[model samples]
Target: MIRFVVKRLWNGALTLAALVTLTFFVMRLAPGGPFSKNRKLSPEVIANIEATYHLDEPLWMQFGRFVWGLLRLDLGPSTRFRDYSVGDIIASGLPYSLTIGFWAVIVATTVGIALGVAGALRRNGFTDYAAGTIGVIGIAIPIFVIGPVMQAVFALKLSWVPVGGWNDGWRSLILPVIVLSLPNIAYISRLTRTSMIETMRENYVRTARAKGIGEWRTIWRHTLKGTLLPVIAYLGPATAAIITGSILIETIFALPGIGRHFVDAALNRDYPLVMGITLLYGGLLILFNIATDLVRAWLDPRLRHDG
Candidate 1:
């Protein structure tokens, strides 16, 4: 188990390093400078600005400086947002994203698992059909479409929640969380239903049944862990993504989250901001994936050996 965990950590470190290197170069080599959109400035002015930010330095030197700053946990200044460090921008937005993401995961996992178990148990019944329909709707409809339609009905028509803003408190979170969780819920339910059905057919499950274990005990003790394996695995990346922020959901709901900053950073060529967020996202993904692997190994000893 120690070897397994160490290996996973080592791999995550390597993945994060490569991510940083690639993102650094790609952003640098991309077509425009952060100042490209600024009001036309004199050549000397641009050169001075570039010098101040070290853009006037060679690419290799810039990369070295970035790495050095990164090692010291400094994200540096944001070019676009005057007086703001990349870290500051991210820090300000993380809480909102975390809150929405946390609740969404809870709602999605709890509801999805229940729906999936019901569907699997009832196979051809109404519960099964309803779950299937939800899965289809969640998967088939894009979030952009869903967000607007929901806002129209819930905010515009019903007036149950504000149209789009963070000032309304908890009521503001409802739409964004629901929208963000919908796809995940759909996916988890489908994965759980399939896994449950397959696990039930395994010989061990039949043996348990032949041994006359109660249905509830058989499901809770013998079946649930196996069914949850895939769901848990999927949750790693899903949780990281939603928690970090859903770009579309954040944009539609006008929520103050880091998700929009990612898009804006890329478009504005805010190198430090872009790199910071990318590293943040990449790091989260790696951490979550490692956590998922560890959890899987703990749940099923076979996975430890496999690792």
Candidate 2:
């Protein structure tokens, strides 16, 4: 177990390093400087500003300095928001992103699993068809489309929630969370329903039924544990998608989160902020994948022995 964990950590570090290197070079290659929008600065003033941020340095030197700063956990200064460091800006927005992502995951997993189990248990019935139809619709529509339609119905027409903006507490969070969770819920439900249906046909399930075990008990004890493996595996990538995809969702809802900061950083050519947020997101993806592997191992003894 210790060896497995160490291996995963080592791989994660290498992945993050490659991500940083690639993002640093890509941001530099893109046209436009962070100061490009400044109104008519004298050449000397522009040079001074560039010097202050080491932007005037050779590309290799700038990369080295940035890497050195990262070694000490420094994210450098934000080009657009000159008053704050990249780390500080990210810190400020982290809570909102995390809150929305967490709730969205919870809702998706809970509701999706229930729908799937119901559909699997009542195959070919109304519940089965309803769940299947809902899953198809959720998967077909993109979040950008869903967000506006939801906002129109719930916020514009019904006036149950604010149209957009993060200042209204739980009511404000509702629309975005639902929008984010929709696709994930659809995916989880489809996966679960298929897995459960297959598991119910296995010999152990038949054996349990032959022994006169209750239907619910047989499913809960003998079926669901194995049925969930695929869902658990999908969750790692699902989590990364939910977090990163929040960029568009945040924009639509006018939420103050790192997703919004990331978009602004990219558009303004703010190298430090852009690279810093990219690294943060890459690290999160690695961490979530590692967690998924660990949880799978814990849930299945075969995985433990194989590892």
Candidate 3:
């Protein structure tokens, strides 16, 4: 297990490095400078600005400096937001993203699993059909559409929650979280139902039943562990997606999260800010996937032995 973890960590570092390098060069090659403005500036003023930000240097040299700063955890300055560094901006926004994502994951996972288990246990009954219909609807609707509709119904028309903004307490979080989680819940429920149904027919499950174990006990003890493997694997990437915040959802709801900053940075050609957020997101993806593998190995001893 220790060796496995070390290997995954090394691979994750390489993946992050590759992602950073690609994003850095791509952003530089794109049209327009970070300092581009509608108003024209003097050649002397432009030269000074470029020199101050090291944009006047060779591309390779700039990349080297950026990498060096990364080694010391410095993400450099924001070109558009004069008062804040890239790190400062991320620090301010990350907590809100994390909070919403965490709660959404919790709700999605719990409800999805329960619905899946119910559907699987009942097979072709009404409960199974209902669960399937709900999953289909959830998957069919995109977050952009869902977000506005939910805001209109729950916040605007009903006036139960605020229309938008992240200032309020739990009410502020509900719409965005629900919109973000709906797709995940649908996917997880389908995956879990399929895995559970297949696992129920496995030799081990049949043997447990033959031993006269109660249906619920057999399911809880023997079936659930193996059934969750696929769900666990999917969750690694899903966690990163949620935690990063949804660009459309954040924009619609007026939430001040990393996703909002990312959109603004890209549109404004804020290379430092864009690259910083990209790297942060890449790191989270790698780390979450590694954690997922470790957890899977722990749950199923066969995985550890194979590794």
Top candidate (TM-score): 1
Query: What does the lDDT read for residue 145 in candidate 3?
Result: 84
- The TM-score obtained by model 1 is 0.96
Cα lDDT tens digits for candidate 1, 76-175? 9999997999999999999999999999999999989999999999998999999999999999999999999999999999999988889998999899
Q: Which ranges of candidate 3 are over 4 A from the true structure?
A: none
Cα lDDT tens digits for candidate 2, 172-263: 88999998898888999999999999999999999999989798889999998789988999988788767654787898898878887767
Candidate 1 overall Cα lDDT vs. reference? 0.93
lDDT of 3 at 76: 93
The positional error of residue 184 in candidate 1, measured at the CA in angstroms, is 0.9
Candidate whose lDDT is highest:
1
- Candidate 3 lDDT at 185 equals 85
Candidate 2, which segments miss by more than 4 Å at Cα? 37-42, 210-212
Candidate 1 runs further than 4 Å off: none
Residue 273 CA displacement from its true place in model 3, Å: 1.0
Order of the predicted models by TM-score, top scorer first: 1, 3, 2
